[model samples]
Target: MGSRNSDRIPIQMRRRKCETVADMAAQGWDVLSKCQACGLVMRVNLKMIAKVSGPATSLWNRKQRCRRVGCTGFIEFQGRAPDMHWHETLAAPSDGEM
Candidate 1:
């Protein structure tokens, strides 16, 4: 029973790798918005874009909200899985925490 449960968890995680924002209402990924010219960073509401663009759009090279008088940067949208942390991803056995 333990083995079976472990097996399903991996499969579930794999299924959640829905890269496209196609399912706008899906609650797994978080989008981060960053501006290069103004150094502005924030989380954006994708609901508006998803509705207009049919939810299959990637925020990869989008430009928005940087209308400052002298700012001339494009907003970069990045989607990331909420469950992953950089430190936990890999560790050497010598690190001892493992």
Candidate 2:
């Protein structure tokens, strides 16, 4: 017999792993995320680490936010050093808004 839907996988396992903004920048990656609840998109600047974390900004973590007028979406960013150019997009669902 096959496993039930609820038993197939844990809810946490189905969710994508969250990464810090700094991690993305270090890997030469920038994130363009949009809110699933609203059609709000934001560009997270991982490059801002130099202003706070020093020259080796790639080793630091930065905070990111959604620019939507009333959106309270936020994400943690800890960019990693990458050998090639990288860009990523993510979808955020406002907590309690869904």
Cand. 1 Cα-lDDT:
0.50
Cα lDDT tens digits, model 2, 5-97, are 533333223123223444455446545545545646555465664556654442122335656678676644322123213322232333522
Candidate 1 residue lDDT tens string, 4-96: 433233322423344346542375556667766786767656676677876776543345767556778766655544443311111123232
| Per-model TM-score versus the true fold | 0.53, 0.35
RMSD in Å for model 2: 10.9
* Model 1 quality (TM-score): 0.53
Error of 2 at 70 (Å): 4.2
Which sections of candidate 2 miss by over 4 Å?
A: 1-19, 49-66, 70-98
lDDT of each: 0.50, 0.41
The alpha-carbon lDDT assigned to residue 52 of candidate 1 equals: 84
Cα deviation at 96, candidate 2, in Å, is 26
Best candidate, lDDT: 1
